[model samples]
Target: MNSHKNASLTPRGREHLVKNIASQGARKAADAAGISTRTAARWKRRYQLEGVAGLRDRSSRPHRSPTRIGSDKTERIEGLRRNQRLGYAQIAERVGVSKSTVGRVCVKAGLAKLPPVQDSVPVRRYEKERPGELLHMDMKKLGCFDQPGHRVTGDRTRNTPRAGWQALHVAIDDHSRVGFSQVLRDETSHSACDFLIAALRYYRKLGVPIQAVMTDNGSAYKSRRFAKLLRRLGIKHKRTRPYTPRTNGKAERFIQTLLREWAYAYRYPSSDVRAAELQPWMQHYNFSRPHSAVSHKPPAFRLGFDGNNVLRNYT
Candidate 1:
């Protein structure tokens, strides 16, 4: 039994009250202890019969409960949950018990939720041996907003019909997990080519020479301009299999993180305000945040940058 802050009697206080009862009368002891006379008398009788053990707290559970479900019913509920995957209401209807009872039984048996089915095919995971061996590129589309959307303001009445759409082009190094991203006006072939050039330039400044690039078979990526740009730079281009986005999983995962940690992560007054925060966020991601794939070290560490050089250049 947990004693409340204003509880008149704890186990120790009960013992003290019992001693006071022995010296004074029950009424006087109850008055001194600030408890009812009947309560004091009951404790005095328990102390007389069972000593200090009686003064200690006891379980509040009743000695027997006729209304509780039996072990057989509990077993039936759990078996239904595990074997038939029946919900609480279904099990209750079958077992002639309340839904809450079935729920309780399921919780106690650790069958509250069904386990996720395992995939038949084992995941084929791979990594590059060196920085710039392969770069993953992808684009994520985001809606433009003039003010906080319904998600932030909770007012669906204010809608911007011609708010337009922006494409977020992202490129991440397969080996280092170093990411470069930009929000552009559209997802056209020209914009894709320009973003790729900017990304390649950024990697070149970091001394990571690009060898190949991987992207999904989107219209912009399949454009002649994008292919010619790669050929001119002497960088090979690899496209994911038809309808297989996971083949270019690194860029896909990077876009997911970008959305969760940056794009919708905050409620900005306008798209421009959100765009302005991306550069600083990217700097933090590249230099400060630890990458689990690279042994919990920052992405810059994989590029072989010493502590001083990283702080001096990237910081």
Candidate 2:
């Protein structure tokens, strides 16, 4: 992706522009989309030749460079720094190179600091083999809005009245990373139970029967009513160890992604308008957005579907 300074359009926003140009003329579409006519024509030609993928931002880095230090010299520099604990000047002196070259190489190799070696132990992460084997649940409290917040407007002096908070309850499948989210007034036990029921129904409609759920030891998840609901549905309920959220990491990570991509993706005049956009954003997340953890495929692909259509006999 292009840096923010150089980027002219987002992928989705570019798609919207090209779609409009299909019906309207290029100049008019460019005017409507607030983009240059040259850009519109170029992207239109790319769209015709390479489709949507062509409109995506390509890497700006050159394919090759003559000034970069050779691998053997970089290795010698690293060896001197690691064994002798020498500064860039000393290392460069020994390696017959300039200090700036040594510094750049050290920065690229993550040896620019004099800190001690960190423990090399790798963190163990596990995922379920099948969808619905384990579901992670969590709630995120978002600030409510009476009007556009300071993030939308440059002035922070305006007194925005408090209207309360919106609790976003989310459930995600541990295996596929598919998520279900809803905005609620509170995170009480009753609300949690209702959200669970609705989430289970939504997953069931997608052909996955949930077997177990994992949550933090929150008051709502620990309530008798929630336990009773789980028992009635024959779904095992598990809680993470106190103060160790990694056990429920899936839901935690989903909440982070939700906040970055959807909740703050665009400015809204009110929370109600933001809430209204959640369902469509959720649909796009499930069916279109590529996930890094799942080999860059959308969550729906792992959930035994191609987009919204079910692919039968998929395990």
Candidate 3:
């Protein structure tokens, strides 16, 4: 049992009180211990009968609870929760019990929440051996705002008109998680091709030559222009299966980090200011920030560069 902060006695303190009682009578011990004489006498008797073990706190649960729900009803409640995935109200209605009673039964049986549905295909995680062997590419659409949105000002009426949208194109090495991103006007095939070229050039500077690129089956990726650019660069293009975003999970994961760290990280005065911040943030992400995928080392470390060297070259 956990003692409250204001509790006067613990198991050890109780033992000390028992010792005091043996020396000076129970009345005097009770006065010194700041407990009633009855309580002191009870502890003394318990210590004498069971020694140190009796001084420890015991469960306050009663030995018998006549009003407790029966075993049959509890089994029925657990069965309904497990088989039918029923809520407390539904289970109570079907089992002819109060909703609170059903909740208590469910909590006792460890069925307070339902388990996640198991997928038929077991998740198979794989990573490329080299940084450039496979690169994951994806895009996220962000609202271009002139001022802080309702999230900051808490004024829903102060909305910007024709704020438009910016497409955030992201590319990341499957192995190192070294990422590059650009905020473009649209997510068209032409914009995707341009971002790919810029990302390729950036990776080349890091000494990582691109071999293959994996992207979601979007219209931009399916366009002939995007395909032609990849063909011209002699890089293989891999498209994720339709409706399965996890196939391009690295890029998706990178976008989530980017959103949290850079995109919505601060309240920018305007879209241009947020766009200007992207380059410096990307530099930090690639060279300074520790990546969990790369064993808590910066993504640059996976590219065979030490801290001092990376700072000198990239900074």
Candidate 4:
């Protein structure tokens, strides 16, 4: 089955050549095969030593490679990648190999890429069993600009003067991953309470009643007004551990996703323009965008609700 581009004699042809040489001599066999006398002799010698095996096209690769990186070095490179989660350049520097070689080694070792680094210990991930069981509440602060900032416009100098700061109040259901957000004036207790009320109404419209709420130990959330509002609503209010934001990881991660997909997703003429887009973005996020943690289905789908309902209202 082996093929050669320039070879005049295949394995069968070489066998014929050897037989011809045995009967008619090397000169006639070489002439018949259209090969040199030296080639005919070489084929005859190969047939004598290896029978048909040697004539069946041997491998052209050298048995040994002097310049190839050693297995020990490749192991070291992969070790750095798997154990330390080093990038290609870092692994290469540590293992004394080229960055490309380190990348290849990592790929071959099945350790080429890793997940993003975590800020805390490997705590178990848990989701509320029911959509209305718990809700995560948090506030994200974004810098207000007169015009699109560097992240949107690409050129840092193209932006107008800084307008001020904007507080983004975000609420997400733990089980369904449904979210609601608003651009607020400040992070005061009154603003937080107002956002919470609006968020509750939004979820209520979707038929998911709120039973419990979790927030970071921010001063605003700890205020008596905020506590009173929660108490009156008969909703259990839990604060995350001091200095441990991951206890409210759902809202934290949601805000990060919002910043990536909405806040910086487009170039806005002004802060007002960006703020206006939040409602539409939230609709898409809840009804259309796939949530990776939830089996790549939208939030509404996870809650056994038709996303088209939200889309219908949007239209």
Which residue segments of model 1 deviate by more than 4 Å? Answer: 117-129, 142-166, 181-198, 219-250, 253-315
Q: Compose the digit string of candidate 4's lDDT tens values, residues 1-315.
A: 568698787888888889899999999989988989998999899889999898888778999988789878877886778778879988777777788888777778778767567664888789988998999999988888876677855687775564778999999999999999999999999999999999999998888999999999999999999999999999999889999888899999999999989888787788888999999999889888999977898888876766666554455
Per-residue lDDT of 190 in model 4 = 94
How high a TM-score does candidate 1 get? 0.70
Candidate 2 per-residue C-alpha lDDT over 1-315 given as tens digits, one digit per residue, 9 for 90 to 100: 554776667877788888988999889999987889999988888888898898788887899988777889999998887777899999888888899999988888888886676765466699999999999999999888867777768778864676788899999999998889999989899999999999999899888999999999999999999999999999999899999887788899899999988898888888999999998888888888999988898987897667655454222
Using all chains and alpha carbons, the TM-scores for the candidates as numbered come to 0.70, 0.61, 0.78, 0.70
Q: Report the backbone clash tally of model 1.
A: 0
Error of 4 at 9 (Å): 5.3
Candidate 3 residue-wise lDDT, 1-315, digit = tens = 898798778889899999998899889988988889999988888988998999898988999999887889889999999988989999989989899999888888888988877757778799999989999999999898888888767899987899999999999999888999999999999999999999999999889999999999999999999999999999999999999998888898899999998977888888889999999998888888998888898898888877787456564
Model 4: residues with Cα > 4 Å off, grouped in runs = 1-13, 23-36, 57-123, 222-225, 239-247, 290-297, 302-304, 307-315
Q: How many residue pairs of model 4 clash at the backbone?
A: 0
Q: Provide the global lDDT of candidate 1 against the true structure.
A: 0.90
Which predicted model would earn the best TM-score?
3
Total residue pair clashes for candidate 3? 0
Clashes of 2: 0
Cα lDDT, model 3, residue 40: 92
Q: Which sections of candidate 3 miss by over 4 Å?
A: 1-65, 117-123, 310-312
The TM-score obtained by model 4 is 0.70
Q: Rate the local accuracy (lDDT) of all candidates.
A: 0.90, 0.88, 0.90, 0.88
Error of 3 at 116 (Å): 3.3
